[model samples]
Target: MLLGYFSLFASGFIAATLLPASSEVLLLALAQQGYKPLWLWLAATCGNTLGSCVNWYLGKELLRFQHKRWFPISQAQLAKAEIQFNRYGSWSLLLAWLPIVGDPLTLVAGTLRVRFGLFLLLVTLGKGARYALLLFLARQLW
Candidate 1:
């Protein structure tokens, strides 16, 4: 039982990162298997949020290498990204649950030096709501 929850947590964490993975499937499966929805939700949310934090940290670290010729992002591109991110600002974190764009948003949040408290709060709310909705749908359909 605990292992199932741990797997869900791990899936959620990995899914939130740049790595290609999906926690939604595991979450729905666990929910359908009669696991406690609340714990599942909490585990997934916390794990996913923490994974985003990892991206955030990486983004902060990435700036250090900007001066290197090996850096992938050009100064012009980084400047453009910074402008765009600033235009959307912290509110963008609410979409951190979204696929593709979500991971980058967290990374940009760190690059732009968004307050950590705000980042965590918005990320947790977005991810928790997503898991909650999945659990609700699972209960309703099965």
Candidate 2:
């Protein structure tokens, strides 16, 4: 019932974060169990988008702590990330649904001070399309 959808949403949210998770698998499992595909898609998309927003916020905040001994990344590494992100520009947010590099891209967007509205729009489009395609494939296969 609602719990299933909430679980999917939570999974999506966690998956989009730096934390390791896979909302896609949960989504497909729910689809197999006969939950409405459209609702699943919506839940997953919103959750994941919100999660990326959190990453963006963290990216903005991290700059303040880059010189701290507890900061996780080295200055060079941060600069490299900034360079890569700048090379790609804000359009890279459109790939926020990707596996390895996706989460970091969202983070970089915030560090670069990308507009929140644009970040949300691109992230939503990328994440929603991914979930939609997964659901479509689930329907076709099962």
Candidate 3:
């Protein structure tokens, strides 16, 4: 029981990082094992949300190296992202829980200098809602 939540927290953390990890399967298995759903949901949500915060901080720090040759994104790409951000607005942060665009959205929010309070609020809401939905749906399957 203790091990399960710990593993889920680790998995959730890694998944939110640039690293490839997914806690969904482990979460589902544990749910079937009769662990309390609310506790499991909170574990995954908090861990994942904290992980996204790491990515957000990394994105914020990347601005320091924007002029360096080794910087990962090109000026053109950054400009394009800026254009998209301008059009889409910060509400796109809600999609931060999604894959592919989700992680990048969090990074972009940081690079764009989004307000930290708003960033945390949006990220928490999005991630928390996702876990809540998953818990709700998973329970129906049993």
Query: CA lDDT, every prediction?
Result: 0.92, 0.93, 0.87
lDDT head-to-head 2 vs 3, winner? 2
| Residue pairs in candidate 3 whose N, alpha carbon or C atoms collide under 3 angstroms | none
Instruction: Identify the leading candidate in terms of TM-score.
Output: 1
Full-model lDDT, candidate 2: 0.93
- Residues 31-68 of candidate 1: C-alpha lDDT, one tens digit per residue: 88889999999889989999999999999888999999
lDDT of 2 by residue, 7-86 (tens): 99999999999998889989999999999999999999999999999999998888998778998899788789889988
TM-scores for all predictions: 0.97, 0.95, 0.95
lDDT of 1 at 133: 92
Q: How do all the candidates rank in terms of lDDT, highest first?
A: 2, 1, 3
Global lDDT of model 3: 0.87
- Cα lDDT tens digits, model 3, 88-139, are 7888887788987777788888888899899899888998898889888999
lDDT score for residue 138 of model 3:
91
Q: Tell me the deviation in Å of residue 123 in model 3.
A: 0.8
